[model samples]
Target chain A: MLYVELIAQGLIQGSIYALIALGLTLVYGLLRILHVAHAAFFTLGGYVGVVVANQTGSLAAAIVAAMIVAGLGGIVVFRLCYQPILHQPPFVPLIASIGLYIAAEELFRIVFGPSGLTYKYAFLQGEVELLGFLRFKTGELVVVFGSAAIIGVLSLLQTRTRIGVACQATVSDPQMAESFGISLSRVGDINFFVGSALAAFAGVMVSVLNNMVEPTMGSVPSYKALAIIVLGGLGSVRGTLVAALVLGVVESFGTIYLGHFLDRNAIAFAFLILVLMWRPQGLFARS
Target chain B: MLRLERFSCGYGLFRAVSELELEVPHGTITGLIGPNGAGKSSTLMCVAGHVNLLAGSIVFDELDIGGLPATERVRRGIAIAPEGRRLFKDLSVEDNLRVGGLIHPAGRFKADRDYVLSLFPRLGERLGSLAANLSGGEQQMLSIGRALMARPKLIMIDELSLGLMPKMVDLCYDALLRLKQDGMTILLVEQNTDRVLSVADHVCVLESGHAVWSGNAADARNDPTLAAAYLGLH
Candidate 1:
């Protein structure tokens, strides 16, 4: 029974990781920005969702508000800090992203205070038995379905729309896309906004599961998502999704069976090292 | 038709092209040739709106388009197949063509893609293949095909014969002339003066960012003294 429950929990956790990886992969693939500040935006979304829900007593409003805030923050960061560094080397923007990340984290801390906050809603906390040995909470089940829905919608948008086509072009070659009359800045800004919103959605899922939120919650997940991106293959969405699922299952089983005392981070690092040494081009490199 | 009057452009104050004046009339091939660093590319970049005009004006179809952005210029029927073929290497050949046709209205992309593919049958054969995998000559054909998808009124090709076998260069120029006969206005920038002079209606020679000579291709071809002086061969 414990083993089955652990597997279920691991799947749910993997879904959240996949959400984070989805956004990270989009921005990294298109704009080639490390965008470390995205993690802070993720934490901000959770806090915002809880605060909005607590104030309005409406889960829908809370989720909308969280996505909107994170999306707007993404636009601002892309326009003000990152876009100007398009012609510069990679290191400048990366350092700038770090500074922005720290600034956003501090700002979140100041606004909501240093401690964690909880959403005392019963809808999320409630759980039901699926079978004699299997049980799942409302939030956990919601995470699974909600993530699938979002991913499905995003894939559709990427494949079918004009903006999606332009985004693919920009990711493939910004200069060539420009020659084709596609505005790199506009596509890049929109992608950033969308990616951040997705990250925010993932944050809300995490908050519902843990029943609490803190400003620093994004740091670990950010590293994990980056690892997922590297493992999946840079600029490859499908690869990131697979990597996220694999990471979630491995980490969950590692924590339970191998003991929580083990440094699970070593798993990510070793995987990264192996990937870099074996296939520096990434596992499913498009070009 | 494209015309540049007293066009000066550069990086900051260091002038790359200074007070250059030139013209490519409607449905005619104009070849721009110069020695290395004689500002052939700088002039093309300025006309394409990739480089800012430091002074003077660029008039494309009688509109002052010098101040427009690169993408905006491209949208206004100005297309440049930049040096080195600047392809979106990760994208499939079809996607690259689709991107080139992005400025067109929604209903026209499929038709444009078909037309461009027909122009370069090699690209049609490899439509689903990644562009990075294409050979250099194939990549050049794809670049030209991609630019053709834009349906531009005027197309500027920089260094059309660079890093290609002599036979491939001949084939490319033949294709370019066919495009010209199909009513596409062309501004050909090349270091291979002999080939360009063979096909151009008019030839303009630039030396150190200034137009040193301009005349009919036949006149320039027959006058060795004039050709030698203008081409820096004397």
Candidate 2:
């Protein structure tokens, strides 16, 4: 019974990780830039959700508002921070991203205060019993099912749509895609918009689960997402998904069994190291 | 249909092609022939808006498209089957064509794809295969077919016979002739002087980014000096 409960919790957590990491992987795949500031978008989403939901008293409005703000913010960051330095070495944009992330975190702290904001009204407060013995929170169910639905639609869009095929072409070869009349700038805008929107959605869901919105909320998940992308194989979407779920389950188990010596987050890095040592190319990378 | 006036292009500082004037009239095949590093590919790439156009104007269909990006140029009916056949290796052959025809309405996709398949029927059988898995000749065919998907008025092909079986080469050249018959303009760059001389209506020989020789293909074949000096024929 404990094993099943842990598995359920891990899978729910994995869904959030997958949502956040998908955005990171997409941006990395297109521009080869590590968008560390993505976490800031995540943080921004939570604040937006909390404020909107509190004021308007509508969860849907909060989600939509958060997505729009974060999506547009992501595009602005790309234009201001990444575009000018794109011609430089990869490290230039990466350093800029790190700086931007730090600045965003500080800005949030200044604006939202250090203590963070909590939900004014109860959200999905009840728990439901599953099968014969297990009980799960309604918020947990929402996160898992909502994330799964979003990912399903995204996968279908990537495989079945014209723009989706165009995105893949651009990823495979930008110059050739350009020659074929697929604008790289347009693709970049779409990628940043969609990726950031997904991150924002994850943020809203996490806020609903915890009933709190904090400036530093994104820090742990952001670094963990970075680790997941590398563990999955850089620039590979499917690999990142698998890595996220695996990391979630490992961390879930490790938290209980190794609580005496290791922290919950430390287990993620340790597992990453072990997996990389065994399969350096990543779980799904074509070796 | 396509003209370059006092054109100069290259990388940031190093000039690969200098001031040059060339034209491809409507419904004709114009060949650009040169040795390696003579800027044959650069010239085509510049026209396709891939390289830096350092100076001068690229007038296509009486429109000066010197400042347009590659995607806009494709919209204006300029397409290139670039050297190296840079097909999207991970995409299926069908999806590659879809991307090529992305600017057109979705309703036009089937017709364009069918036209490409008609031109290279082998692509029909392998539409599901990843481009990286295709043979060298098939990749070349798909490259040309992908360009054709845009339904361009002028199609530029660079290094058309670089690494293909002779039979495949013949098939591609035949497709060019068929495209010509359909009133499509062609700008061909090739090291195969003999092949260019065999079919090109107008020939321009570039040396160190200058047009060292320009005339009808007949005149080029009959001139002993040009034949011996550049065509590798005595």
Candidate 3:
């Protein structure tokens, strides 16, 4: 029962990391930028969903509103912030993103509150039997299947659609993409929109899972997603997903076994350090 | 038709090409020949809106295009088979060609792809193969075929024969001639002065970003100084 609970928690949290990291992977893959403010989108999405769900009492409405709001926020951030510093220096855009992250956190504090907010979701509350001995929350199961569905849809978009092919082509060669009449600016904007929406979706899902939304909640997961992308290979979607799951499970098991001295974050970082020391090029990256 | 006057373009704080004037009229092949570091590639890139243009204007069909972005330039029927063959190495040959014709309707993919395959039949065999896996000659063929997919009014070929086998060069030149007969305007840059001069309607020789001579191909062939010094003619 303990093992089942631990594994289930790990998988649910890992799926959130995977979802958020997909956005990071897309931005990094195409624009070659880290986009730290992606966390802000996630955080904002949670807040938006919470407010809307509280008011409208409809999870569907809140989810739709949060995604749309976060998606637009992404486009705006790209145009106003990221685009200006695109060709400056390597760290220029990165620093800009970090600055945006800080500003967004402050903005959230001002708009919402500095404290955390919790939800009383009447739907899918409490735990149900998972095999014979193990019990799991209905919400956790929804998370597992829901995130999987999102990842599947995203993968299909990237692999099967023409626009997705264009995105891949742009990622490979920006100059060639432009020559072929595929606007790089347009691609950047579209990617920013998609990536931000994914981040927001993960934010809302994680908030619902925990039944708590905090302004600082976006940071740990966002940073963990970043670490996962680096560990999985920066631009490889498959790699990011695998690395996210591994980190989630490692953090989970470490928290369970390591006792009160070491936290999940510390365990995650220690694992990251070991992974970096072992495979600097990333575990699944191709040469 | 394409025209440039007093055009200077380069990387930041350093000009690669300067004060160039040339006009390529309809249905003609203009050979642009120069030695290494003569800004041949830079000039083409600037015209394609990739490099920084410091001064002057680019006129295509008498409309000023110097202010346009690369994709807008491509939309206005200008295409380039860039010097490095810059094919998306991860994508298959068919995918590369499909991207080339992206400005057009989706329904046109098959027809445009078929047209390119007809020009470079080798690409048809390697349609499913990644561009990185192709030989140098096949890559060059794919590059040119990819450009042809754009259905451009003017096609620019930079170093069309460079690093290509004689047979492959012959095939590419044959396709260029076919395109010319189909009423396409061509601007060809080449290290092979003999081949360029043989097929070119007019020739412009650039040395160190300056035009040393410009005339009909026959006239350039007849001039003693240009023939001996630039064209390697005795």
Candidate 4:
């Protein structure tokens, strides 16, 4: 049925949103920044993935290259921009991130042309039959599997590694973490790089699903992801996923039942206001 | 041996400890006793490389450790149980010890963890509980135990008796005595002058950021002039 297909599409979109939100939540949780340029990283990743795939003629190589570049971009941004403004007022970085976002968008437009480009990754096209009533596009399946894999690896890293332990400690108390000899700056760099890399991967997924990429394609997804992150909770990873899926399903059903005339932006804003009014801290804020 | 030569350390332009010349020979317990704002914690911070020195040199076993970071200092066998018992509150008591052992120059987690648990048997019973869930006395014990996991040659503790019941303080001091018996050199900073001096081999009194009196604990206890001059008490 069309309803099932719409649900499938929404779920795939939600997975990508969840990925972006995960990264955004992480950097915000650690550094307490809004990181308005996060969407810029997403768009950057899409363009990079396309260029890399065309150059290498391999999807895996393209995704990996996209991730590396985005990760490094995150590190560079932290080192060159965030580091200098660490002691300044909160608004300094917020305004600075806006500048960064604009700069990244302009750079992308200049490099890739203002017009959107079509993706030619043959492997990502076509559909597969699932159960009797369910079906999924190859890209949708990739979104499901790829996002899960990335989340799994990150969870393992967070719970097991020394760097991860140090990060958690730094989040708890930067001064105390420093006393233990953990470098807060290095942790910031790593968190930024890794988080942006995940967003970059989501960008790649979006490009594959839509069969096209644009300079400002990340704009809508980033906004939705940010909304999802807030709805879930500021720093709660599990909450991000749950909130993303719920939003995805709700939007899917809303579009079908209430007619396409119901603007998604309005719906999202209404939901955000309602939730914040009821629970200002989000659903599962870590206390 | 750890030696400080006219060491002055503080935050920014404000000096908390100045002209502090002291030494803790290997395998000895040294107490730094003073009233509030007398720079006992600053002196320990200087030795532990947590505070930047404004002037003078801190030499640990003949190495100028002024340029070293805190972890490097710990790697070189200088560990600190800082003021306020700053534990990783969200982490389990066992995980706290795990991270403490992570900075160890080399070791197996299970083995070193077991060793730390053995040293603080109370921690063994609460290994699964988060650090914040532990009582103040238990958290203090966990902090000290974490430092011990590093197997440092010199351990500097600040206000080990802070915010604890009198009985808990006795238990904490008993552990300090045991650490001494096991041949760990220590620098203890506290306002509990009588309590620290009673067990200390040597005692240094800091007043207005300068060493006002330095002598054997017996001498500090016996000399009325030095005692009154340092703390305005006998």
lDDT of 1 by residue, B1-234 (tens): 899898899988889988888889989999999888989898888888777799999999899998888899888898988888888886788777877888888789889887776667778899888888998878888888888889999999989989988877877888888888899999999988888888999988888988888889888888888767765433
Q: Which regions of candidate 1 deviate over 4 angstroms?
A: A1-11, A55-61, A85-89, A124-135, A263-287, B12-14, B163-171, B207-210, B226-234
For candidate 3, write residues A1-287 as lDDT tens digits.
Answer: 68777787788788888879888988998878897889999998899988888888888787889999999999999899988888788699999999989998888888888898877556457788867877777777877898898778877886667787788789889998999899888898888888888888887877887788888988887788889999998898889989988888888889989848898888998999999999998988954
Tens-digit lDDT string for candidate 2 (A1-287): 88988888888899899989998999999999998989888899999999999999988899999999999998888888888888999999999999999999899899999999998988887998989888888988988898889889988998799999999999998998998889888788888888888899899989988999998999999999999999989899999988898888898999999968999898989999998899888787743
Give every candidate's TM-score on chain A. Answer: 0.93, 0.97, 0.95, 0.94
Question: What does the lDDT read for residue A86 in candidate 4?
Answer: 78
lDDT of 4 by residue, B41-119 (tens): 9888777777779998999989899888776787888888889888999888977776676665435777877766666
Better DockQ candidate (2, 3): 2
Question: What are the DockQ scores of the candidates, in order?
Answer: 0.64, 0.87, 0.77, 0.45
- Docking quality tier of candidate 2? high
Docking tier of model 3: it is medium
lDDT (0-100) at residue B214 of candidate 4?
92
Pick by DockQ: which candidate is best?
Answer: 2
Candidate 4 regions with alpha-carbon error over 4 angstroms: A1-10, A254-262, B224-234
Look at candidate 2 and tell me the lDDT of residue A208: 89
Whole-model lDDT values for every prediction: 0.83, 0.91, 0.87, 0.83
